[model samples]
Target: MRLWVCIALLSTVLCASAERPRIVQGMIRAGQFVRDAAGGTRDMYRAYKDMREANYRGADKYFHARGNYDAARRGPGGAWAARVISDARENWQSRVSGRGAEDTRADQEANRWGRSGGDPNRYRPRGLPSKYYTRDDLHLLWLCRSAVAWPGTMRLWVCIALLSTVLCASAERPRIVQGMIRAGQFVRDAAGGTRDMYRAYKDMREANYRGADKYFHARGNYDAARRGPGGAWAARVISDARENWQSRVSGRGAEDTRADQEANRWGRSGGDPNRYRPRGLPSKY
Candidate 1:
C-alpha cells in the first residue's frame, strides 16, 4: 500500500506539471491576440486620420486599402479586427447615413485587396503626393522616369533621382486643390448641366422609382455640379423652380419640399451623392 500511494502521488505531480505548460502557452497566445487586435484598431484610426488630413479627393480608396492591408499584416487577430471595423463602418453608412450600395461594395473590394496583400497603389489617384504613399521608392522611380533623358549618363540620372527623392521627402506636403473651373468652361458646363437634369428626370420617370427619390435628386445635382459653376447655377435654378411647382401646384407638403431642397444643396455643394443613395439601386447608373 505504501508503494502504491507513492506511485499515485508521482503520477499526479507529473500531470500537473504537464498541464501547467499548456495553460501558460494558452495565456501567451491570448495575450498576443489582444495585442494584435489593439494594433489593428490603431492602424485603422491612423489611416482615417491620414485620409482626412490629406483630403486628396480621389485617394479615398487607396487609404481604405492601405488601412486594411496594415491591419491584416498583424495576423489573425488583426485581420478579424479590421474586418469587424470595416463592416461596422459600412453598415452605419448604408443604414443610417443612406450611402449607396455600389460605393460600399467598392470600398469592400479595396479593403479585401489590402488584406490579401495586394498593392493599394492601383486606386492611387494621379498627382497624389508621394508623402501619402507607404513605399517611398515610388517617388524615386517617378523622378527617374521624368528626368530629362540624360542620354547615356546613367550615373547622372541615378544621382538626380536620389537627390530629388530626398528633397521631396523633406518638403512639406502640398495641399491638393481641385482647381476652380475657368470662365471659358462655363458655356460647355451649362449645356452639360441641362442635359444631366433632363436625364435625371427621364430616368426617374422611366424607372418609376418610388423608394429613393432623395437619392435621385442628389445624383442629378451631383452630376450637374461636376460640370462646374454653370452646372451648379443651372441645378439651383431647376431645383428652386421644381420645388415651387411642387409646393404650389403638385401639392407636395412643405416638409417634403424642404427635404428635397436639402438633398439638392447637398449634392450641389460637392457632397457625395452616395450619402443620400440607398442600397439595391442599379449600379449601371
Candidate 2:
C-alpha cells in the first residue's frame, strides 16, 4: 500500500512538472537521468541516446512542417541543436559522477562504510531515502541545460526559482506550527495536573480538620461526665479516643506529606499529576 502511494505521488509530481516552464521540465528530465545513473537503476546512456534521437526527430518535423523560409530561418537548428545536446550530456555526466554536493556526500558516506568492511550500498542518508532525489535539484540541472539549449529562458528560470523557494518555505511552515502546538499542549496538560493535585490536597486537609474538631469536642464531654463507679471505664474511653485521634492525625499528616512529595516529583518530571487521581473524585474538587 505504501509503495503504491509513493508511486502515485511521483506520478503526480511528474504531471505537475509538465505544467512548469519548458526549461524546468527539461531540467526535471535531466535530473531524473542523473538520479537513475547514481542509483544504477536504469541504463542512462541508452536513455540519453533515445532522448537525442527523439529531439532530432522533433526538430526535423518543426523545420519541415512549415515550408515558410522565414520560419525555418528563425528556428533553432544545426549549431544550436549541437550545442544544447553537448552541454546536456556534460551536465548529466557531471551530476551522475558525484560532482554535486549531495553526490559527493553520498560518495563520502559510501567510502566510510566500505572502509569499515560494511555494505556501502546499504548506507542511507539521514533525512532522505537511499534512492530519493528532489525535484528542485532536477529543476536546477534542467535550468543549466536550458541555458545552453535556449539562452532566452535564463530570466524565466530565475523567476521560477524564486517562486518555488517561497512556495517550498510556505509548504514547510505547517510542520513548524504543528510542533509548536504539541509543545503547548504538553505544557497545558502539566499545569492542569498540578492544579488538580493542589485541589486534592486542600480537600484532604479540610476533611482532616473537621474530623479533628469533632474528636476534641467528644473528648471534652467525656471528661465532664466522668463520675463514681464508671470513672475507670470513662478514663479508658477517653484514653482510647485520644489515641484514635492521634493516630488519625498522624496518618493524615503522612498522607498529606506523601501527596505533596508525589506532586512535586511529577512537577519536576513534567508528568501529568492527574494520572494518579482517585476514581470517583470530582473534577471540581
Candidate 3:
C-alpha cells in the first residue's frame, strides 16, 4: 500500500511538470526580435535624414539660380524693353515658389510622428496592459499555473523564481517592433518625398536654364538695337550678365557632376543613395 501511494504521488508530480508552460524560450525569442527591430528603426531614421539632406542640397542650387536670374533682370538700367525676359523671370519665380511648397510638405511629412513637448519618457516602455504587460503580473500567473508541479522541491522553487524574474522582466518591456514599424513608415514617406523633390529640382533647374537662354537672347537683340547711341554701355551690361549666368551655370554643373558621381558609387555598391552616405557635398550645405 505504501509503495503504491509513493508511485502515485511521483506520477502526479511528473504529469504536472509536463503540463507546465515553457515561457522562457518564447520570451527570449521575443526579446531578440525586439532588439533587432529597434536597431533597424535607428537605421531607418538615419537613412531618412540623409535622403532629406540630399534633396535639400539639390533644391538649393535652383534657388541660387533663380536669385541670380532675378538680379540680372532687375539690373541697373531698370526694366528692359524686352518682354520675353520679364516673362521668363516670372516663370522661374513660379517654379521656385512651387519647389519651396513641395519642400515644406516633405519636411512636415517626415517629422509627422517625431517626439513632441520635450517629453523624454514618451518613448520609454510603460508596463500597462494596453501598452505592455507588467512583470509582476506575468510572474504571478506563471507561478499559479506551475505551482502544483513541484510543491515541496526547494530547488524547483528557486529555479522557477529565477526564471520567472528573467522571463517576465523581458516580456513586460515595451515592444520595439511597434516603434520599428513607425520608423519604417517614416522611411517610406521620406523616400517618396526625396524622389519628388529631386524631380522638381531637376525640372526647375532645366526650366531656369531655358529661361536664362531666352533672357540672354533677348538682351543680345536689345543691345544690337541700341548699338548706335549707348552701344558700349549696353554691351558692357550684357557682357556682365552673360558672365554671371555662365558662372552660375558652371557652379551648378559642378554640383551635378558630384551628384552623378555619388549616384554611380551607390549603384556600384548596390546600395540605395538615400540609405547610405554618398561622396558628395556635405549635407549642411
Candidate 4:
C-alpha cells in the first residue's frame, strides 16, 4: 500500500513539473516566476537568455557574414555553437563526472539549456533565429549561464571562462571564416550557382528541388555536393577563389620570393639607370 502511494505521489510530482510550461519569447516579466518557487518559477534561465541575446545581437553583425549563415547551425548552438553549451557541460562534468547520465543537477542544467534549444530538438521549441547567434553568442551564453547559476562564485567559473576563450579562439580563427568564404565561392563557381539562375529554374521541375542544388556542408558532403547538380559552377568558383586563396594558404610565398619584389617594393629594377641595361642586354662591367 505504501509503495503504491509513493509511486502515485512520484507520478503526480513529475506531472506537475512537466505541466509548468516555459515560453520566454521577447521581453521578460520577472514578477510571477521570481515569486512562486513551488510553481517551478525561476527567472534564472530568462536572465541568462536575456544577457546572451544582448551580446549575440552585436556579435551576429560582425562575426557572422550576412545572407549565407543558417539560422540554426548545430552542436550546442550548432556544430559550432560551442560558446553556449561547452562550459556548462564541462563544468557539470567537472562537478559530477562519474555520475550516471541521470544525475540530478546535471539533468537540471541540461533541461534548462535544452529548453533553450540546445540539442536534438534545437529547432522544435525554437524561440529565435539560430543564426541569430554568432561565435561570440556562445561565449555570452556560457558566461551568462555561469553567472546566473553560480551567482557570486568566480573561482571555478574563471577557469571555465579561460578554457572557453582558448577553445573559441582556436575554432573561430580568422582562417575558418576565410576558409568558409572560399568554400562558398567554390560552390558558387563550380556549380555555376548564380543567384538568379538558381532561383529561376528552381521550380522549373517542381519535384521538391527548393534547396536541391544548394550546397554547403562539411568536408565529405561538401565535396560530394561539389559533384552534384550545379556543383560544376561551385567548383569553378571555388577554383577561382582558391587561385588567390592558395597563394596564402600554402605558405609558398615565404618559401620562394623574388629579389625584385623585396627590393624597393618593385618600383624599379636594381640595375643602375646609367648602365642602360635592357631586358636582354649585358651592361658595362
Candidate 5:
C-alpha cells in the first residue's frame, strides 16, 4: 500500500503536466542548484544508510559488553549472573527478530504457525494491476506535445526536448557551442529514453513482457545518444540525472559541479538567474 501510494503520486505528477509541458531538467541544471542543495535531494539514501549503520554499531557495542560481562560467571553461585545473561539475550533477540539461533527458531515456529496460507514473498511488493496505466496513458507519442516545460513535471518537458536536436545544431553563439549542442542533445535523448523507460515500467506492472520489449528501440537509441553525439559529459550528467531522479528522487552533486564548470567554461552559468528558457521552461515546475 505504501509503495502504491508512492507510485501513484509520482505518476500523477508526470501525468498532470503531460499537457502543459516544461523543461524540468534544463531548469534544474541551469537554476535550481540552490534548491537541490537545500533538501539534500541528492545522496539522501546514502545518508540514511550511513545513519542505519551507526545505530546498529552502537547497539552491538552496548549489548556485546553486557552479554560478555554477564556470561563470564559460572556455577550455581553465579545463577544470578546466568539469569541476567539469558534475559538480556532474549530481550535483545526479541527486539531484532531474535538474535541468530533464537531468531532462526522463531522463524521456524512462525512458519509452522502459519503453514496453511503463509506467504514466502510477503516482503516483496505486489505488481500493479494490469490496467494501472493503459497503453495510451504511458505512451509518450500520445502524450501532450508541450507536457514537460515546468520545474517539477518531467514528462512534457521531455517530450519537447525531442524537438531540441534540430535547434541545437544552429545554436552557435556560445564559443564552447559544441558543449551546449551536446548538452541539448543529451536533454533530448535522455528525455525520449526516460519516456520509454516509463512505458517499460507500465508494461512490467501489467506483466506485459512482450509489450515491455517494444521499448528496446528506446534502449538502443539511449545507448547511442549516451555513447555517441551526446558523449561522456552527457552520460555523467544528463542520463544519470534522469535515472537517479526517477528511481530515488535525487541527483548527483558532483555531476552538477561538473556541469557548472562546463557551462562556465562556455561563458554560460549553470546557476544564471535570468536563464534564457524557451516557452517550455517557465519559472515553476
Candidate 6:
C-alpha cells in the first residue's frame, strides 16, 4: 500500500509537470493576442488622425484602405480588431451621419481591399503631398518614370495605360509623358470618359433598340471606366444621375432601376459587358 501510494503521487506530479508548458504557452498566446489587438486599434486611430490632418480632398478612401491594411498586417488578432472597428464606424456613419448607402458601400469596399492586403495607393488621389506617403509609396509612382520623355496626348495615353496596367499587375516599368493635362491628367481622363459615355448614349438613341438597352448601359460604363480614375469618376456620376432621374421621372419601377444601376456598376468595375450582350445584338456596338 505504501508503494502504491508513492507511485500514485509520482504519476500526479508527472501529469502536472507535463501540463505546465501547455498552460504557459496558452497564457503567452492570450497576452500576445491582446497586445496585437490593441496595436491594431491604435493603428486605425493613427490613420484616421493622419487623414484628418492631411485634409486632402478625395483622399478619404485611400486613408480608409491604408488604416485597415496597417492593422491587418499585425496578425489575426489585428485583423479581427480592424474588422470590428471598421464595421462599427461604417454603421455609425451610415445611420447617424446620414451618408448614402452607395457611399457607405464604397467605404466598406475600400476597407475590405486594405484588409485583404491590397495596395492602398490604388485609391491615392493625385497631388496628395508626398510627405503623407513613405519612400516605398513614392517609389511606386516612380515606376512611371519612363513616360517622362513622351510628348502630346500620346504621352498621356501611354502613361495612363501603363499606369492602369502596372496598377493592376505585380510591377512593370513605364516612361513619363509631357503635354499631359495637369491635375495628374485627371481632367483629361475624365473628359475622355465623359465623351465615351456621351457617344454610347448617342449610339443607343440612334439604335433605339428596345431589348438592347442594358447592353448600351454596360458598354458605356465599361468604356468610360477603362479610361482610368477620371473616366471612372465620370461614369459613376453619369450612372447615378441617370438612374436617379429615371427612377423618379421615367416611372420605371425601383426594381428595374436597381437592375440598371447594377449593370452600370458592373461595367464600371471592369466586369465583362458581353455578359449583358443580348442575343442578336449588332456586332458594331
Question: TM per model?
Answer: 0.42, 0.18, 0.17, 0.17, 0.21, 0.42
Global lDDT of each candidate = 0.70, 0.36, 0.35, 0.33, 0.35, 0.73
lDDT per residue as tens, model 1, 142-185? 54454446566875755564544433431222222101112223
Model 6 weakest lDDT span, ten residues long: 170-179
Q: Candidate 6 — which residues are off by over 4 angstroms?
A: 1-20, 134-285
RMSD of each: 23.7, 30.9, 35.2, 27.4, 24.5, 21.8
Q: Highest lDDT: which candidate?
A: 6
Off by over 4 Å in 3: 1-173, 205-285
Tell me the tens digit of each residue's lDDT in model 5 across 1-285. Answer: 989856744553443221323454443333333333332222222223333444543223222222222222112222233334445545666688636775545433333322222221221123312222111122323333545444565765555543332222221223353344345545444555445444434543554333222122223223333333333334335434544564454344655445433432221111221231223222232
The count of backbone overlaps in candidate 1 is 0
Colliding pairs, model 3: none
Better structure of 1 and 2 per lDDT: 1
TM-score of 1: 0.42
- The parts of candidate 4 lying over 4 Å away from their true place are 1-81, 98-185, 188-192, 195-198, 201-285
lDDT of 6 by residue, 176-256 (tens): 321232234565568789999999899889877777677778879999997778899999999899999998999988999
Using lDDT as the measure, name the better of candidate 2 and candidate 3.
2
What are the per-residue Cα lDDT tens digits for candidate 4 across 1-285?
A: 989856744543333221123322111123222223212211223324433664633232122221012222221123133223334554576567676654434444444443343322222222333433433334444544544545466646644543443333321345554444344334333434343233323332343323221211111123323343445344334434533564678665632223212221211221111121123211111
- Residue 245's lDDT in candidate 5: 66
- Clashing residue pairs in candidate 2 are 27-142
lDDT of candidate model 3 versus the reference:
0.35
